[model samples]
Target chain A: MAARLARAPGISLQHSIRHAAILLVAGRYRDTDRSALCRLHDQLPQPRATAWWGAAPLTDVHDPVTIAEGDDPVPQLRRLDRDLLRGARASEPDWLPDEPPNAWRGKGDHGQGGKGMMGGVPYGRPMAMMGEEMRDGLMLDAMTVTIGPFLRTLPPGLSLELTLQGDVIQQARVATPAYSASGIASEPLLRAARILELLGLPDLARRARISAARGDDDEGLVAAARRRGALLALPADLADVRARLDAALRRGAAPDPGEECLVDRLAGMEWQSALLRVASFDPATLSRIAPAAEPEEGEEEKAA
Target chain B: MTAADLAFYVLSAVAVVSGWRVFRTDSMVRASFLLMLSFIAVAAIMLMLAAPYIGMATVFMMAVEMMVMALFMVMFMMNPAGLNPMSMVHQNRLSIGAAATAFVGLTVAVLFTDLPHEKVARQAPVIRDLGHELLGPSMLVFESAGVTLLAAMVASVVLSARSGRFGPSDEGSRPPGLEPGGEPAGRVPESEQEDE
Candidate 1:
């Protein structure tokens, strides 16, 4: 009977993952306690990479280096890369660095970019010397590694926390950052609300977006619900929505009758097809926002 | 009173007291001690009956055996050497009922039995004559018994011990750097080592 009691896995008393993590590290607790803690830990949502330093392009000639390049005496940089691969291996796994590795060059203007890179620096080595104007042009051509590309595809408004087991992501904890008062897209609810609005749920989408735009992402569902109620209180119609979108799109310039007619025709199309059209616009829009410049000088060509 | 009767009464009293203590004591160690006492008492009682060969043997053998048992009780079961509660009888009412029934049945059988009162065939004590008898024709049997007992002791000690706390016997001479205390010089005590 004592043995039986000893063996019984106790119910989890730890309500939070933080506490469970503490228990896991301490490991002084009984099997019952540990079991409860483990269950609690497992129950915690997997974390997302809220912001990621995206993939660095690899290269053979100059190994990619990711560090700032100012002229001041550099403080000793901590060695971050453990067992960094010296050369290519026989069996190259997919997760391993890509072959014919595109060495990361700093953010450059589209097509003018020379190599694969994270942030603005070539990961491991300085760029080959180019003429002054060409160097500036090369610098401007390097790409900004946005975490947004991977993030945009995830289910919106899901709260996410991430953990890395070595280089690989071991766990992700999803939780809506609904309580942030900044109304920033950082919160899942506002982000979700924004996405919904971007997808064109005008009335439903506008409530959170307006609150978020007003920098109040902390607005609770009840307050958001109340705001939604108020919006609903307005005398709304399809014409009102079209009028509003037209007014917004027209702010920068006078409306072209031909473009307006095309917009109207597209607006009337099925929601599904419209969604595909909107998604198709993403790459072009992203490129427009953060343009990549073309490579200015070819080192090999110059040397020849 | 005869030595047998005196011994019987003393052992019976011990058995009853220890049996009572086994239930009364809250500590597991105490309860086990009481149990050991009872077994030893029973062995004594067995010796008291003209069963000298078995009786004295049982006393000497069981005493040594039970002392080792006491050491075990001190070592392994948590709070070794401390009086920790260890009541195996969890279902008190059920156990009481079962035990009472058994006691009553056994008491009735003992009280009603027509026990024989046998007369001794020998006038003198048996030990002297038995020794003579054994040395003459049964010396081999005596020697075999001694051998058997030696083997049993060796086996029991081996079985009870954990593997190799002594490690391997260093070659007849100590290995390169072992000191007089059979350990490396400047070695921290085991307790301190565990702390680090």
Candidate 2:
């Protein structure tokens, strides 16, 4: 369904909510994800509308545009976009309240807060504290952030609590396991296409997607990707990733699920590389490898 | 005032204001880019002062430098996007005093010093002259510096590589002992020692 949307000429799928005009809620979401969904809906820029594609609209959403299952959402999306621009349809109001998540509590007159520049939670969030880095043992500000469940880079429905210093992920903890992959979603062609998209080869990714949709075994797709230097684009040290990508393109059998935990493998890796490595695994394998922790109270876990 | 003189004043104001904003902005990324804008304004002033090569070079160099600086800021700084209004400045009294003194000293020097009045012809090959200056009299020095930079780049790449000539660079690789193999020198990680 996502591939069909991507193929549609008028409907451009955007990764960031800030760039998108319409919030397309697809697939089933857990009850716990309601707040996160509301947050995502609120994040879209003004003059926006929410369209539910084969998914139930949230109870709070007013006058929702719900597309029936097995129906193509492209035409409806186009109409929604056109109506938005023409002011024919009223824009959806923010689902979440327009207020800061945390209250301001600063010490000084100017709300300068904190002691000496490093010791305050100005807006309920603590400043990134200094911690020793893994590679060289340099003291750097390490930030803890919860990413995904909806972040386009990683597998859908997967969420991680990451401790980061610069671009490098110092530590990673799986907060939510990814959705179970349907047979179609786990197909090798689509899997290969996902990696190619991350590698910035959108043309090749499109070709792979088209091939999968057509149900035609295009042997030359892998060769063309190789010709475009896809393997070389990955870092040499990421040989495992390169091998997996090659195997994916050839529609090879799934690799043996490794003994090491996914979180352990992710640590000490740069964020982009770590995301790519995570994407290399099929969803079922990913869930098996990444032991999920119970979602902590107040942790923002977005709907996939 | 002539148009050029008017542009000079405007650019000078922009440069100074942006430079001031660099310290005032809460976001580290915004501060770096503000500094870049300040540099660009100064570069435009340089162009108006009839040094196109230097002006253009300054614009190019500062753009790249500030981009890198912004990347580092996003990586290292807390609250890089200025979501929460936070103060970027520090050392309030001392920094203010130092900045005021420097500004006064520079202003006094600018007002009193004998300044160069000579101007290069508009059609003169300033870039060519610069190229000649760098490659002729200072050829050896420039070439040596370039070579040194290249060497440093290569050495850093080699040192940072995870895979080495013998094996995985990070896997149980230890520095040799000062004497024989009494013990591997430096701080061996407790984890690696435990593995042994």
Candidate 3:
């Protein structure tokens, strides 16, 4: 359904959450994912609306346009966006309070300086401290930043805190496991379409998306897809899995075994490659192999 | 002042302010971008001064250089977004003294220097002569600089390769980073009997 939203008329899918006007929460998200959902909502610049389609209402959103199962959300979503843009509907206010994430103000009466050269809170953020450089122990600053859950690069609802050096991901650990997309997870063609999209073979990805939408025999589409070197374009390991899935989808065969845990596969890979690897897992395998969506008791509130 | 004079004044002012911001701003990414803005302002002044070739090169080269610098900033700099105000500075006394000394030196140099008189028509010819010098006896200097940069590039690659760029001792790592490339999990392209 999310796939079809991109192809829908009068609607362009926003790859960056920053650009999106209407936040669409489709399917069942983890109940405790409210903070993340709120964080994503707050990320959209002012004059934004959220559509909670077949998902539980987040606490931060006082009012949301809700869509029932079997109903098309795109129309409702478009209506909300249009209304907000036209000023007919007031843009939803931010759920999180307007304040710095932490008390970044400097300590002491003067508040001009700190231990050594760093005074307390320079412009409400601290100066970066040098750390062991990733390459050759040439001391460099090591920055840790969180990516996705709402980030367009990752599978929807998968967030990770990444330690990085320039373009290299030094360490990657899941902050929030991806929202279990159970409905599409089992469908081999749908999964293949997703991988194709990540592979930058969008035309073939589109064909796969179309076939997945139609939900019928895709033999002709598969034939055209193969001719386009859809399978050949992928790196060998992924290509092998994708070809197997594509053939299976064409002939209506059962899904092959999952390639396995995406975390290790994702780790050490750079941002783009990590995304590709995350998208490679067949949905069924991903759901099974991925860490459970529900967080350990205390970990829930600690996420933000 | 003439329009060119005014442009030079405004652009030079902006360049200096932004150059100051490159240090004053805490955000590494912002500082990198600020430096690009400063370079661009100076480049614009160069254009106004009739150094079109050098001006344009500065603009494009600085833009690319800043982007690469930003990438590295994100790569290595902790808290690249400045989410947390990390204002830790070391050797404040020395840094301030050095900055003051350099400022005084530059001012003195500018005051003492004898610059060429206004010769707009001759600017093109001057550039042409500079082009000649590149191919003339001064070629060794240019060649040496290129060799130096090439060596630096090789050195960085080798150093990073040993430490894995991500960290030390990560060998046989799969799905190598965006910058570094080695054998990334070889996926054998199996011929699947052309599924009938």
Candidate 4:
């Protein structure tokens, strides 16, 4: 899916949803993530189109065109783009309401302002709540945000709620585990291509993707990829991912990743490093390493 | 009003609103952004006052600084997203008094004091002149400050390193296979776990 979208001529894939004109949802999604997907759809600026390929559509998106198996969605997507760009097709209307989630228009009585210190909810999005820092017991504003399922950096269907402290992840929870990457995209070359894409080595990434799509083992190509320093540039924690890709290339076999504790691995890691660690593992491995079972009563507070 | 005057007023208004929003907004993330907005407006004012380099520098530096601030707020702040209305204040009355006092002092100084200035003969190469002044008699001071900044940067990197702080075990120990010492750093060896 990524290979097709990436190789698509003149239809650049935007990393950020804010810049996106269309939401190309591929594969299946967790029913629980319906609200999140809707929020993502609404987040795109006005006149956005959503195309669901081999996936069910939630009612949040209006007039979504579902692409059947073996159908070329590129033409439909191009037409949608052309229409939207030329003002021939009216831009898709917003599915979500325009108003704030809560009633926040009331004025503050005293200078104390709103609910707490900052004037409460001048808009719909509520302010972050306080939490103690994990590194030190010192209290700080802990920003909790749910990222992905759709985020570029994350594996699709993998949703995480992170409590962060200044680029440091104080805590991380896998709100939704990642699904196994579908189709031949999970081939070692495609996987390597995806990793290269994440590493900002786009030329090598495109080569790997295109080479993989051709459906043959090219030892020289893998050697060329390695020569490009894409594998070598990875941090130490990502060595396992590199090894897995290496093993898959050598022996066309899937390595079973043993159960690893997600929080233990992610906690105390900076955001970039955490992202690298997450991306290092194949989707299957990542899914197997479920976020640690919710702590028991005594351990719950400490976990939080 | 002339375009220049109009631009100045519009920029000033933007700066003031952003400045006010910085303290008023509950969200730590939003506050950081508002602060950036204020800085950008101030930078534009600097540009209008004929300091293009300083203005652009201010814009670049403040943008980076505010991004870092937002990251910090996201990490360390109690409520960066501001889901709940938060009071990011303490000693409110004292803060109000201090702010008011500073405002009065600044206003009085600006209104009542006589400022002396003479047009410089060669203002075109002001940056070059400033550079020369720094490298000439002030070179020692400049070098000393640079060294100090370098040391601080080194110190911060060392302190913030994941492996260095508190204890080595604070971070996960290396796998037995990865390490050269033929021993695990902290976690139980897989061989030992298998036996147990």
Instruction: Give me the runs in candidate 1 sitting further than 4 Å from their true place.
Output: A1-304, B1-11, B39-57, B81-84, B89-117, B121-123, B132-147, B150-196
Please report, as a residue range, the 10-residue window in candidate 3 chain A with the lowest summed lDDT. Answer: A295-304
Report the C-alpha displacement of residue A182, candidate 4, in angstroms.
7.3
**B21-127 per-residue lDDT for model 1 (tens digits):** 87776555666768878877887776555556666776677677667776665443432322222344578899889999999999999999998878545445777
* Candidate 4 TM-score over all chains jointly: 0.65
Top DockQ prediction, candidate number: 2
Worst 10 residues of 2 chain B by lDDT: B166-175
Prediction RMSDs, each to the true structure: 33.6, 6.5, 10.3, 10.8
Ranking by TM-score: 2, 3, 4, 1
User: What is candidate 3's CAPRI-style docking category based on DockQ?
Assistant: incorrect
Candidates 1 and 2: which is better by DockQ?
2
Cα lDDT tens digits, model 2, B1-196, are 9999899999999999999999888788889999999999999999887889899999999999999989878766766766456678889999999989999999999999999887778889988988898899989989999999999998987876755677556565576788897687765756678988
- Number of colliding residue pairs in model 2: 0
Please, what's the RMSD in Å of model 4?
10.8
lDDT of each: 0.37, 0.77, 0.65, 0.68
Best of the candidates, lDDT: 2
In the range A65-168, model 3's lDDT, one tens digit per residue, is: 78885787777877787788799989888788888654645553445323334335544455556654434444566568887666554556667787765556
* Candidate number that wins on lDDT, 1 or 3: 3
Which runs of model 4 end up more than 4 angstroms from their true locations? A59-64, A107-113, A118-120, A136-138, A182-186, A218-220, A245-257, A291-304, B1-196
